[model samples]
Target: MAPGLPTPKKYFVTAGAAEGSTPLNAFDNALLAARIGNVNLIRVSSILPPGTEFDPNLELPPGSLVPTAYGYIISTTPGEIISAACGVGISRESFGVIMEFSGKCTAQEARAQIENMIREAFARRGMELVDMKIEAVEHEVKRIACALAAVPLWY
Candidate 1:
């Protein structure tokens, strides 16, 4: 609620994995693969504001300041596995909760962690979870690799 900082009205979930010559590059490429590398991401906490809707076909403007909740892992050890995951738990008639996790693990494991975290968050808030969405990615390191999962909120 400021002049140039408007509240987000829509959101989307995505995941990607990539290998690169360096760690940063791997992360950037992973974001690009996730379709969010062009914009400037302003990392935010794990709360989906009330009334925000989910849009899977969101096309963000390049260089825009996008608010996001994300988790990522970059590994340089060759053959090592890395994973990231994000989950959103929607309440019946109110705000939702977002959770992200990343580490040396499989995508399935990361997904499991995110799911449990979402459940715990809902329980802590005493909110009724009516819907859930999750995304995950896994990467196997060659030189350097990155796995990323994100929930990008936008207008």
Candidate 2:
């Protein structure tokens, strides 16, 4: 947490609208700025297009109201990994990623761990966290399937 920083803020993420969307809404624009600008995202309370609020803390369903967007949290790793995977000694400064199925319960289960992995990957490559842009949307088909399979059949 940074000094004099606000916490527990509600961010509204919209699809097909970056920062330049008509009928601009303060909440939506603020959320977009926070994410595009790489501000620490605490939690996304609500989203648009119906059935997108997937709150793990509350153990809610995949469809809450927040529509699937894509691209979640961006770290300093993907860039290095992409470069390394391609057999490059030097990598770019930052990498932009689209977190497929961010709001899907099944896919989101591994999100935290995956985020850590991304961070580690960047650290190994000797890169620092410059900025991150996350796209949140409905969970991907594959990720949802994986989550379903992970659950117990008797449940």
lDDT of 2 by residue, 33-84 (tens): 3232223223321212122222222321332332222233211221111000
**TM-scores of the models, in the order given:** 0.96, 0.23
Candidate 1: the clashing residue pairs are: none
The C-alpha stretches of model 2 lying farther than 4 A from their native spots are 1-110, 138-155
What is the total number of backbone clashes in candidate 2? Answer: 20
Error of 1 at 134 (Å): 0.2
For candidate 1, the 10 contiguous residues with the lowest summed lDDT are: 1-10
lDDT of 1 by residue, 1-155 (tens): 54876889999999999988888999899999999999999999979989999999999999999999999988889999899999899997889999999999999999999989999999998888898899999888888899999999999
